[model samples]
Target: MTLSQPTDAMHRKGTIISVCRIGLHDIPEVLSCGLQDFLEKPSHYFFALLIYPVIGLALFLWASQGNAWHLIYPLLAGFALLGPVAALGLYEISRRRELGLEIEWQHWFSALRSPAFPTIGMLALWLLVLFFAWLLTAEWLYLSLFGSSSAPSGPLALLADVIGTGRGWRLLILGHLIGFCFALTALGTTVVAFPLLLDQHVSLRTAVAVSLLATLKNPLPVLGWGVCVALILILGSLPALAGLIVALPVLGHTTWHLYRRLVRIDGSVAIDPKG
Candidate 1:
């Protein structure tokens, strides 16, 4: 009877494994279904794009009260706050696809239902990292400009000192170098890491590791994508941030595509043997 009990347990385990296998194989089809859902739902896309401008306008109004330089902090803070808002839109796209429903603005609240808190948390973390990166680059720029010393009291004098030194040229180079290094380090992981975190209940460490591996495995493609991202950022800054209306959404959708390409959805290998 004891031997038969062991055999029965093994049989039950095999059945569970088979069920999991079937679910894993279904992932590709699920992904396709999701894409189709998004394509069919143009209203949702429109609403997502609209939100950015509304938020931007509000920031502009708030910052109009302060000196021009004071506005930078609020601008950065606004963008950080909006990261989750953007992710919520992406989540709507993914969730509607899962339900085989057409995308619409109405789907926004629905998308916020699942993985909402986790998505917000991850976005907040990423934005904090981005803010620090900006600060580091800003400090580098300031030092490059002022030569690491106390500045003159008068605005005119400060301007004169800056103009007298050939530091502007060097600042440009140093800023670009720092930005490039930061991009490369974060290239692979950022593309898919957040979406994966939202989609799966897995720990952040696993998702980040998987993302890094994906980047290392396809360095050329990831680097190319990074260059494209940099170009878009530069271009978007040219027309008083008007370019962001189009640039941000395009990059966001493209990132979704990149993530789809990189992550292995098939749970063919046992993630946890004990399970």
Candidate 2:
């Protein structure tokens, strides 16, 4: 929250962030458009998304080396909490393509030069904090169920403890329930805020407020989108996190088009930058 008090006056500049209600059908349409965007520039998009697999492998190695095998699932599932931040560059790529600009790999970093970078940084920090909070909550939940001293020897041992006994089922049910709450918070807050800030001159508060309104207005479609994302990330994490090379870009590019459908900017003309 590095935003100063006077920054609130930016809202008085008369920018109107409006939310639109959309049906479930719009989900596939946006995904299709996002696929088209990625296909048009697959090499550039894939190169830009290499960070996801790299991070996944790093996390896997860290968990393995530390014998924190119990954390492997939580750490991987927690990725959804940070997905919006990871996809910032992809949003910029989709934005450039929308404007019919000739794009290069370097353009993925365009979000860094945005007028709203400070605000975007603040939002990204919030997501990071949320991610760590989830990890801690997950650890606490495991400790309460199995005691702090009971560390499993490996992934197999961990799986046996989690799936073989009654407490294991309890952990599974309760863990997923709690994880759902964290995921919902991330979705409701930033599902559209990041892209809106990048695409418009609106204040952070206005952008987040509009994002929440969009979620509330279109709960069914938004929820479906979240479910789809969770499933994709789960599948992508299968091959040593290699699947994200495709999952990340498609989800990232689609998110921009999704934001376009969810929120409409008014009162200020959105400028298309020229090279």
Candidate 3:
């Protein structure tokens, strides 16, 4: 992803980002290839999902030991925000796979050591800010809706509050609506931004703009990708979130392949419209 400096780019010192036109069909193709890649080197990708089980296990532990079961819901919903950051490892694995190199434990952990480290760091900070903002918004929503009554004494009380009354119904509906907004914003802005920064020495601004343009150009695939991510997250949330141990790395690798398919050197996908 080394670039020739011609002074036309703004995001990095000498690189241009590409935004390729894609279609709904490209979605499955990219995902299938990515899953194959993950399966090829299951160990590295397993370490990628290792982070999920750790987070899931810790959250489950806290939920079991504390009465704040309600607190876990917001954190779980915000997983999508942290997901891109989490997938940094998988991105590294995917990058290594594409380069025909064997994975090394020492170098694989060095995702932050890219020449584009500053831009990637800035993007990560921005995502973290969005995550905290979502958390605060969820807290404010609960407080505004139920005031002091919103606090649940236990897991059953929390369950009842979420499904037992009109206020409960209101909270559930509104909270999901707000969470969807946050997730959608994140999806649009970061669907390819992180991968682009990982794969190329591009500026944060270029990476983001290219990501947005790619989404806008390929609405159907992006829409499908969003649905896929949400469905996997929901499935992962079941069984104490253990499913994420398998789902996250697969999807993380899928996202890298998606970026590969969605961007081209000249900002156009080499696909036949009628194919």
lDDT tens per residue, model 3, 90-201: 8777777777667755545567677677888898898899999998898888888778555787778888888988887988999999988888888888889988876665
**Residue pairs that clash (backbone atoms under 3 angstroms), model 2:** none
Cα displacement (Å) at residue 183, model 2 = 0.3
Q: How badly does each model clash, as a count of residue pairs?
A: 0, 0, 1
lDDT-best of 1 and 2: 2
TM-score of candidate 1 relative to the true fold: 0.64
What does candidate 2's lDDT look like per residue over 1-275, in tens digits?
11111111123367755677777888888899888988987887676678778988899889989988888899999988999988888888898888888889888888888888899999999889989999999999998999878888899999999999888898899999999999999999998999988888567887778778888888998999999899988898888888899888889989998898887666777566742
User: Candidate 3 — which residues are off by over 4 angstroms?
Assistant: 1-16, 60-66, 266-275
Off by over 4 Å in 2: 1-12
lDDT of 3: 0.75
- Report model 3's TM-score to 2 decimal places: 0.85
Q: Name the lDDT value of residue 27 in candidate 1.
A: 31
For model 1, residues 87-181, the per-residue Cα lDDT tens digits are: 55665465445445565566555535544456546755775676576666666566556645654545455456445657744654565576556
Residue 155 of model 3, lDDT score: 74
